[model samples]
Target: MSETPTHTRVREQMNLSNAVYEAIDTPTASGEHAHKVILRDCLGTLAVALENSYKFGCASDATHSRMLGHFAQNGLTTNNITYAPYPEYRAYARNIRRTKPKLYSAPDAALAEVFAAYGDIARATWDTQGNPEPDSRHAVHVTALAAPYALREYPDLDASLVSSYSLVHDILEWHAGDTPTLNLSTQGHVEKETKEAEALELFCTTFSPEYPKLVTLVTDYEELVNDEAKYVKTFDKLDPGFTHFGNKGKAIKELGIDSPETFWREHHNTYVRMSRYALDFPRILEDRDTRAQMIEELAWPSAQ
Candidate 1:
């Protein structure tokens, strides 16, 4: 196994807080604040690592570009120095998998060992996509720790992209299952239904005075979906909040008018509004006076 890198050690320290785990489990108005703190700490460490790498000139720009290309190919990001087309990178990755099967094969190795290797690759890939100059030692250590599970589950998949996607999904999943009003009538489905109901309720109540505007936003989103317009391009550029609130608005429209409520109840958890609000709420709360005013505003019933 590759020696764990020092930066990876630092990252582990950054992410090792029990408070983060506890905060994730507990839902409160302050949950967003907790998440931001964690994200800021993690990203800050990464930034430091990148700066160190730059100072040392250990890794070349070409290497960084290649790593970024790998990320972009995997639907991770498109902001790399190369800015290589995603499809091209995807094709290259596919070709490499097909042509160099030995690079991924683990003949005669224990399943655990193979899995560990895969997890390491996934972690490296995640860091590469997230930042070109991730703390080298830290990234290596993280990848080493994470590789085994990823390899065990998806021997053929790109472990890094899969890991990245999983991280994003897990963050989004936390907002589910809190409110009983949103819980689906159906049994055995994911608990996202409950979360969706809560979000819809929040949007309706919080923006009640703006119902006409909400309806219009929903209508536009539905139209864009039906017409198969680009997902990010379908909404008004003036207010991204409307676009976010309209997450899955296209899917909801397909259910037909008679079943709007039923459709919303069923798929509310799948919408992006809650996730966006959760992420953005921290920034909104950063201003001490503004946060105080918001607390006051939110304390009152929606009718007010």
Candidate 2:
């Protein structure tokens, strides 16, 4: 049978969406060309695509609109996506794989290498997306480290399983780089998920022999078929919010989110996504909101 109207519209949307990624994958030009200029081009492509997709009445029209709202309210000039230094991490992984024999003989050295690789992968700042400072900025390893501490509240869950899921949940980012929850179009999200899966396969084939359990842990976390995965997932969502509130909305201010309207408009999408966790971890959800309230009411001087 011929394609349905829905399929045709979605195909068109995908073409537009793919263009956004194509613009990103394009190399920066030589000589005095600012890299930020490339991001402008990418967003411009994304804007046209989203506008057309919304007009076609795609299922994600609201999501598309909110994404644009996020950029608009937060400041159109903002650079949200950051990438890790290319080939550097790839080289490091290769080096680790080469020395796997020696590392295998010395368990401490092997573990250290794993932690070191993870330590180099940075988390996103409150304002932007991607992994900019893999060496210095917010490290994702902190989320793994904090998992056990957060486990105290959920006393009945399997601590060992939770810990395992946390440690490996973001391991693929060592190669894939961190993709923020809010920064991408639906197609952009799909491309990121594909890239991350490819990275995970690389890890399993190259490094899993040395770190055998890694494949299981990463896969289980992705599948999220157990309480352990769900528990770890809750922490993953909360970690950034924890950092945001702990820093007293410092980054939010840097993004010029001085008003409640701007702050909520930018954050409303994330808050709605986080609300689901209330089913499994009510306290975690409550903590997120309580802290958010403080930021909205007290952190913004103009709001106060």
Candidate 3:
């Protein structure tokens, strides 16, 4: 295994990160789709290493991230520069096999190892697309890291126009999710749902803009289900305070809509609305089962 100097390795990674940022984030970023895929892995490796270096205060430590904002505050300091890269990349690539089920070719693995070798990568918490978090600057970091990787593809900076324009699109989605709700009224509820729907659109559109037409079907289905949500009615009603514990059941005798069958019978119209959206987005119908499960959760008298 070859060992690159820690400083040289970091410089290389930083340069690659910058290239990747320009490739994926820049306005009118020019690149074939396949090029962006490899670039994402490049950014992921550097970002993971930087995050991990900050986490453990050294390249050799096997520790989870305790984000002290080391990169954010001091940037990459000298003490964090001792990276044993090729072997480090080997470890990261080998480890990927355990979690990533996709079959990787020998060349792909070699490419991943080389791509990952420029930094001291740390373990990353895998997250689902349903709830992307760290509501902070993750997207910025990812985009920033993408720049140097772009340079290999489009070397002439004077000739190529790369834009982090998607960063704005991503940030907009984050803003939408971060948009606060005043209350759980229909207005506030729709606003929140609409924002979530838009966020999904922005995220999915990174692959295809046509994605939204189908994705919206899921969003609209959710909105329709939310409309039938019992908690909506529960919010407006006055809480039956039991100042006197002597009377337990006497405080509230709200009509019970406990069973799924009962709920289906009572809210048949609402289910119809849900079905309509489901039928429209058949591609995602399997993903919308949360409503039936939620119905049971919201069946409590207090919830209703």
Candidate 4:
């Protein structure tokens, strides 16, 4: 018997994820070159996984098959190409079925705008330092992709609102791009902030009347106002941290970060900055502790 389309899609999605999962373990020579190769491979794997998961969730069987075929053909060619679902697939999937309507409303114009704005915005991480074309997923999509898993720890929070917050938390960054400003001077920070603020104002004015809650969620996320928004913010930090950890901190180690304290304090400062929020929500705190211990163990495995 032939496999059903749903089964085919599930298998393909797992294949995409497992390809990266296995690639991560392949040994390589140690050096800057090796780190660059590892970073590139990891980012590529993440991009494939994120895109595959999204297409599997939304695309019609025919559309997905076409996409899969295109990707497979490209894999056979020497011409450099990145696999991506067509825009028509996304627009057509506007009416697709959703398990959580609140978190994912069908035929939502505001949500459509959010998705379009973030479609190609590559996130800036330590791993993507000098690459002209980093295969990184956008923060907007990251939030939506991570919502189901992240919300499991915070059962008390409103999943809908928190998921909504995750969807739009980085909506303001739509126009400005995800430029890492860690070493930027005060004036530079002010300029970037101003640009982002203008972008937010424009977004809110365009969609606020129709999507007041979404706009409010974006505002709350920027201000760290409420528990739901704060949770999304924390998850934002953890999402990338998890990516780094999955890649075995190659990016961090390449940046000369050798200790857990430095990793927590410098690169992924999610826990350091949001520890206060964890105090108010012990589940968040517990999750932090668990992850922190994992990082510590990863850093000093001999001690374990």
Candidate 5:
């Protein structure tokens, strides 16, 4: 089937990102070089992020062929002229799928993290050292920044579909990870009060009112995800997942849930709901006349 105009647009973006990545030069090591490289790297994978993220009407198989074709064309066999793979199809298609968010949301989480890291880089209080070092923060940002468009696009996002706030929620607040004042990932143990609910609360507090539906959805999601965080905290004494956290399956077991499959049923259902809501934002959040006033009313105090 001929690619839809929407998919074509995605393709154009993909090509553009590839061009930017290939053409962008990393200047002599310096903060300025680092910033340019950072933005360049972000544009580099935005193609795939857009591919997986942009849904037309409702989540469906409409983009599956194009997704596969995109990967096939970008793979090693394509012998394309681009120096680096624009959309590493293999990476995107690691798991065949009927929809984008059905199987995994990590890429979404990962992409969100990329953006969050952008905020981090922006918010980072530089050390006494003269220039910012392209350290782990830059590495994590770049790593997540590079992604190919994914397996079958999520079913067409329709009115019935609800977008997910997970990525947006997660990207905003972090756990014992990188922060503006500290490198939690490397040396901070400020795990007190930092949990999924804490994360959701921060996002909810930050973005709600301006986005009431967002507040409602996450307010509900907090009830579900909060337990996972509690379990993670309980098991903090043991380094199970090497995530400094325990697995959800184990969390369920400890909680006496029916089974892993049952837990995932809830997980994926919520995932689908969240995905739909997120997908619909383009249509929903189109006008800022209301949002502007709403944001002004509830905008973070420090934001102004």
Candidate 6:
């Protein structure tokens, strides 16, 4: 079989990379306290996205073949080019299907399967009768789908970045436990508090020297919280009367915190810096301009 054309390979790799980053950047839940239902929804969304990427690859290959045919007709290449490597592309497509087999089996089947698994995990975790660990099968499926995309995009990325990203996915799955219960309480104070605390812990521990800029950005955020008299008010000014501290007002209300300051102190890392970090993954991977904008946003307060 002939190898895939260089252009096809490049496009496949680009799409895969974009998809992987999107998966990472998209939020999920963790632990016994997460909402299994929403977690299932998120997984379903990811599975569909992966499938779409496969279809996109197929279409891209067809387009490229037609273009190549035109080139040959015009005598661009004397050799008659045959596009036979379409099957090779299936390796990546197969992994996506394999990861979410039940979902891909039929229309809406995968979503139902994901929901069932999510329900099982959520019930088990919330009941407190047994360990409510995330569904291993679902976790495996997510990682398998994610790995190929990651490898294709940042082929040269340090193995550790890949590992770290996988771990991030795991954390999101675990957090899914909290999603179901998020809106149950009308006040939403407890949920917001819990998320803020969780986000803070995640932010501080996840940063490393390999991504020094990320670390620096987080550090600056910490400084803002620590010297809130100066920075908290400044952030508030950014959205006047909006209260930009401690998971912001909305997250604070969702997590159920009395004051943004309290939320900031307890979960400053995740709520402020880490949340932003997670959201930044796609921008950093897909668009240089977005990355620059992010860095500026993260560093703005500190620079002042």
Please name the candidate that would achieve the greatest lDDT relative to the true structure: 2
Higher-TM-score candidate among 1 and 6? 6
Best-fitting candidate, scored by TM-score: 2
- Tell me the whole-model lDDT of each prediction, alpha carbons only: 0.27, 0.45, 0.29, 0.44, 0.31, 0.32
lDDT winner, 1 or 3: 3
On the 0 to 100 scale, the lDDT of residue 109 in model 5 is 51
lDDT of 2 by residue, 162-209 (tens): 544544566677677777664345686788889888877886786565
TM-score sort, best first = 2, 4, 5, 6, 3, 1
TM of each candidate vs. truth: 0.20, 0.53, 0.21, 0.51, 0.27, 0.25
Clashes of 4: 0
**Tens-digit lDDT string for candidate 6 (124-211):** 1111122322443223223323333334433343222232222123232233343422223534557645764565455445534223
Q: Which lDDT tens digits does candidate 5 get at residues 111-169?
A: 34544453344322221232232232232222222222111122232211111221122
How well does candidate 5 score on lDDT at residue 50?
A: 36
Model 3 residue runs over 4 Å out of place are 1-72, 77-132, 157-163, 175-304
Off by over 4 Å in 1: 1-147, 173-191, 194-304
Q: How well does candidate 3 match the true structure in TM-score terms?
A: 0.21
Ranking by lDDT: 2, 4, 6, 5, 3, 1
Q: Give one digit per residue, the lDDT tens place, for model 3 in 177-243.
A: 3432211345766786687677556545642342233233233333434321221112111011111
Evaluation by TM-score, superior candidate among 2 and 6: 2
lDDT of 1 by residue, 43-159 (tens): 222222223333211211222233333333333332332212123333434433322111111112232232223222211111212321112222222222222222332234344
Each prediction's RMSD to truth: 23.0, 20.7, 21.5, 12.7, 19.1, 18.3
